[model samples]
Each structure stands twice: as C-alpha cells, then as structure tokens.
Target: MSEQHSGRRRRPHYRALSPLREHLRESFWFAPLVACVGAVLLAGLTDLIDREIFAEATAEQTADTLLSFASAAKSVVSTVSSAMLTFIGVVFSISLVSLQMAAGQMSPRVLRLYVRSRLTKATFSTCLATFVFALLVQLGYDETTDPTRAVSVPIVSTVVALALVLLSLALFVLYVQATLRLLRVPHVIDRVTRESMQVLTAYRWLAPPPGQEAAERPEDPPDGPAPQGPVLLHEGRAGVLRDVNIRRLVRVARRHGTVLHLVPRIGDFIAPGTPTVLAAGGTAPRPRRIAFALNVGVDRTMHQDLSFGFRQLVDIAIRALSPAVNDPTTAVQAVDRIHQLLAVLAPLPVGELRHRDRDGAVRLVQSVPGWEATVDLAFTEIRICGAGQPQVTRRLTAALDDLLRITPQPRLPPLLTQRRLLERAVDAAVPDEHNRAFALAPDRQGIG
Candidate 1:
C-alpha cells in the first residue's frame, strides 16, 4: 500500500489568510476602536430618535414629566462621563502594571499573550465605549433660553449611559480576575503549552502506517552535467523569519522551473545581505519574489514557529529555577507540560522538510528540526539549569521516562540518552542515597 493510502486521509488544506489580516485580528487597538465607534453611533442615533419622540409628545402631562427629568438626566450623564474618564485612566494604568509584572517575573514574549488577550481587549473596549457613550449623551443635552425650544432630555440615551456605567463596573471586576489569573505561574504555563500544542498540530506531518512502505522523501536536485549555477538570495532587512508562504513558493519555483532552497527556518534571524535561499535550476525566481514569500518580523511569533513554543516554556522553567525566583514547583509544572507536548509529538514523523508542486515534483526545499532537536530544545536547558534542584530533576526524570514509554523505537535513543544524563545529574547534585532514589523515581509532580 502507498504511504498516502496507509495513513489517515489528509484534510482539505486551506490557505492561511494574509499577514495583514492576521495582524489586525491580533492587535489590541483595532477591536476596541471599533467598539468605541459603534458606541458613539449608537448613542447619537438613540439621542436623535429619543429627542424627536419627546418633541412630538402630544400629551401635556408626558411632556411636562419628561421636561422635569431633563435636568437630572443631563446631570447624571455629565457626572458619569467624568467618572468614566477616570476609570479609563485607572484601567489602563492597571493593565500596564500587570504587563510589567508579567514581563519581569515570566518571559517577556508572554507579554504578547496578554496583549492579544480577548478579556483585556473586551474590558478596555467596554470602558472606552462607556466613556464615549456618556460623553456623547452629555453633549447632546441642550437647555435653551426659550422654554418652547428646549430640547427634551434624551431619557433613553441617559438610561443607556447608566447601563454602560454598570457594565463598565462589571468589566472592571472581570479584568481584575483576569489579571490575577495571568499573574499565576501555573495559568501562564498552561497557556503557553496550549499555544505550543496548537503550533505542533498545525505543523505536524502524517507518517506512514506500520509495515507500509514509506513515501519517497524529496531531496535537492542532484548535481548534473548541466547543473544550473546556485543563485544566492540576500536578505533585504534584519528580522526573525516568522512565516513562509510555502504554497506560493512552490508556485514560484514551478513557474521558474527551479528548485528553491530556503536557508533559514521560521525562527531564524537574517541580517541584510545574508544568503537567504539557494536557487538551483534553469530560471531563478526574482529575489523580490522569494522575499515576498517570506514574512519577517521584529520578533518571533507563534504563526509557524513550533520551536518558539518550546522556547517560551523553557524560558518559564529556567526562570522559575533561577536563584532569585527559586520556585522548583513551578519548574516542575513546566516540565510536566513539556512532557505532555512531547508525548503528542513522540510517534509522529517530525521535520518533513520538502514541498512538492502539483505534478509531484520537488519545488521547495526547507530545513525543519527533527524530533531529537525538538526534544533537546524542550529539555536540555531545563535539565542544565535545574540540575541542583531535586524537585526539577525528579520531574525531568519522570518526564523522560514517560516520553521513553510512548515514543517509537527510532526516537528512543535520544530519550534514553536524556534519561542517563538526568540520572547522572541527579547522582552528582543529590548526594544522599535516599534523595537520589527519590529524584530517580518517576514521580509526576517531582519529589513533592
């Protein structure tokens, strides 16, 4: 049976949305600005319609009653508008402080997580919308010198403004809860783990089923008598390679009748004039065309970089194990989560680095880290940093044991080597036989 037939049927692959759209979606300002505009319009419409209804009131009693409430409504809206402004300042200050604390205590990259948080966006939007609504309603109130021409108070708009105040209060409570959650170490670790898992899922390759002949992996075109000279594409600017338009690159290669070799992976940094790709074929695609297919950014993003997830978790673990922090339990938590992620990756064939065209011809050749690299990225640093900490060592040992049990035979050698290294570290760091035994034991929560 063919590899494709032996494995699960592939799902329909949809092209990712453009980078600009993704950025706007992840931005903190866009959604809140949208909410502010919507609130302004809604307040304006409500004021206009309510004012008209008051002007057209046929009953003298209703007109007099509404007129009596006009002054009070205006006063209420004015006060709420001032209060909402104060609230906005306070909320923004709190958010900034929370971000600072998170960056100082945890990984700075996690600040992006807080920035992209829906709860934070919703809270800010609600507060801003309330301020705008109250301000607009307050401005619409007109106390004319002539009684007959007096604008009837927009009772509906005022009431809605009051409701917004209440909603803002509720959102404040939620914001506090969310900030607390974000500050918690376990919550932060879990969030990073979930994000890393998502990246892993998106980038994982389907391996052929057991006993089925594996698919012939695509390799770079072999040197030939008429070998095309390698074309070196240089980077135009310095930044991290955040994403790559693989399908587009494949199309570009197929168009130029060439095999494009990408020099950098998703998380690599390339300075200007650095060799970025080596094109080998009849017609090399324009440098701009190749560059256009790559998305470079000031910092690494979770968009296509799987190692970034591990980098984040490892950062948290090492930070937790640091002398200033001295929180081995948190480190253990991070290792456990890393172990969970490794379990998911253990059986899969990682680092499938070839992109083929529609005609089954190799078009794009890119480098991807295999299982061993990923495992090393995930564990090696934590192991070295947390070597002296018994709790971290125990958790690391347990994690390796768990991985060794689930990982396929070909992937075992690395896990076994990691296990031995961990044991040696335990022996060296933990002198007491009892403590060493405890550290070597596969305890999920470490020694504790």
Candidate 2:
C-alpha cells in the first residue's frame, strides 16, 4: 500500500520535472558537465568561507579565533543552511518577477501584488535583517592585533567567491534570456511548459470516441452550406508542374491510402482527361498545360518585359525537366517527338517546345548519390546516356532563344485582370510528351 502510494506521488513530480529537464538540455551544457561545474563552484564557496573565518591573525591569536569561530560556525550550520535555503527560494521568485518585467507581461498592479508575496518580499527582508545583525556582532568579535595582513587574504577570497557567484547568476540570466527568445521564434512548434497542470490538461474536454476502430467517414460536404474549398491561384490555367511538385502529391496521397494509382511523374504529357486526385471518395480534374507566349493574350509587337519573360522561362524549365520518357537514343529524336506532339496539341504562335537527351550530367559532372532526404531535397543523380546524346550544356544555352524572342509588349493585360485570356489559354492548352523523354522527379505541390 505504501509503495503504491509513493509511486502515485512520484509520478506527478516526474511529470513536472520533465519540461525543466528538457529546457536545461537545450539551454545549458550536458547534465554531467553542469553537475561538475556546480561541484567546483560549491568547493570554491566552501574554501572562501573557511578562509574568511581562519586565514588571518597571529598563530596564538589565530588558534583562539579558530576555536571560537569553529564552534560558532558548527552551532549555526543548521540555522544558517535553513536560512540560506530560504534566501535561494526568494532569489528564484524575484528572478521570475524580473523576467515578467522584462517581457512586459506584468503591470504596476501585478508588481505590487508580487512585492507582497511571502517568498518574494518577506524572505528577502528576513535574510537582509539577519545579515545586518550578523555583521554587527561580527564587528565586535574582530579582535585583531594586525591590521593589513590580518584581513587581506580573507577579503580577497570573499571577493573572488562573490564574484564567481555573480558570474554564475549572470550566466544563468543570459541563458534564460536566450531560451525565452528561442521559444518565441516562429519555427519551434512545440507546447512545452513547466506547469504539470498545463501539460496533463486536455486541449478540449470532449471525450474521445471509444473502440480501436477508426471514425466513420462522411461521403461529402453538407448541402446546407458547403465549406470553402482551396482557392486556386491560377484557375483553369495550364503549365507543366515541376519535379519537386509531383513527389509532394504522392506523399499526401499516402495518408488516404497506402497505394496511389496515378500516372507517371514530372513530364508525362498530362492529357485533358487525366485525373490528378481521386482520394477519400473525392475526385479532382486534370490541370491544363500552357506555353505563355504561344497560347493567348500575346502583344502585337510580340515583346514582353523582364518579369513576364522570366515567368515564361520558368514555364519552359518546367517543360524541360518534366518531359514524358520514351527511352530515346538521339537528341534529334527527342526534339522531333516533343515538337510533333506539342505542335498538334498546344500550337505555338511563335517557335516550338524542344528536347535533348544526353548520356551524362553536364552540370557538376558527378553522379547523384542514392540517398534521399525531404529536408535536404537530395535525389538520385541524373544520368545522361547514349552515344548520339547532344551536349546538355549547348542545348540548355539554345533553350534561352525563346526568352530573347519574347520582347516587351505595351498592351499586354495583367494575367490577374485578363480572366478570358487565361480561359482561352486553358482551352488551347496542350500536353506535350517532352516530359516522357526526360528523367525528372515528382512534384512538390502535388499538381499532376
């Protein structure tokens, strides 16, 4: 019975200790290192106290002083330790008050209330009064024959010890300040706290549904008022999504089901009827693909500004990296296939979408390592192969010709303002097989 009762009490204390331990783990050195530093500081304090009582006076007078002082110190140890422990407690309470002041998390009324707290005000007052009374008595007991050497060593020791205490306290204050700032930062995303009640408390009081089985599903949104779906940034517009975008979609699908039935990633000529999402008994329509300069809303001068040109370049890049793969041997075949399909589907008003196949990577000239990482975004090394493979470097350079062609036009409408232009572009959008000829990764945005 006693053991069970003790265990129950310990469990609550352990829960309270957890966050403090976690905070210290992050803010200070490792636990063993802190312990060693604490031990050394304690030793230094002990030595200072010893020196203050025993370092000075003639050998004969010192002996007498030692006898009296040791007796007094021994007799006072229990009382002084208790009182010092109380002082330490007050220090913590005041330190907390100081923090509240620093953060502007306190006001004048709260400050007055804090001042009246037993630990904050009364304990400090008691310690202050005790120290003054002790000093007066200590002054009467200082029966020294020598003036200079009699006090110098003890004074120096006390000063050093006090300095070390102040240094430690300063270090702790700085640590707390830094930790508070770190906790305030936007990225941490944790709800750690020192209070056990805060920890054990539920976010909501509603009882969880019973049983090991999962909750039942609703087929669709309510008819009374449908909840808002995601707002599209570019509604009904078509442009090839990037490699990083595809993989992110696959990962999101995994939550709904272990197996996702989707078409090839990156550059698979996503046809008009191709579906991007069919999950949770819901379906999403295919995305339209467009080439900006060729599709619609082109200016008479056929010129574009830097920003619009940059957007077109990005679209070209998306088309470049995300092409349909067909195991082509020569660069010419790759380009011919891409040209034929795109010309039939998304007819370019100007030039054409192109492709090139190379045997090995032109950039960095190294194989991509096999390891994968979400945070690092590392993927398999892209290999360029085949004897007739074109120079990836030269082709990449040639790809810039389209950017040069899209000159600045005065009358082009903002894509935002010209909804009809986007609609027309989507209507004319075509899926080119350039994605198939190229080796690219999945999309991050989950757009097919």
Strongest candidate by TM-score: 1
Instruction: Extract clashing residue pairs from model 1.
Output: none
lDDT of 1 by residue, 1-448 (tens): 0113323454323265555555665578898899999998999789888878777762453676677778888889899989988998999999999999998888898888888788888888988998888888877777753446776568899888889888888988998998999999889988888888876665454343355424443122223453245766654678888878877888888898888878778899887777777788758778888888787878887766778888888998899888999988888888888898889877655665556665656677676677878888988989888888878887888888778778777778888888888888778888999988877777787875
Cα TM-score per model? 0.86, 0.22
TM-score of model 1 (CA atoms): 0.86
lDDT at 360, model 2: 13
Q: List per-candidate RMSD values in Å.
A: 4.1, 25.6
Model 2 superposed RMSD (Cα):
25.6
lDDT of 1: 0.77
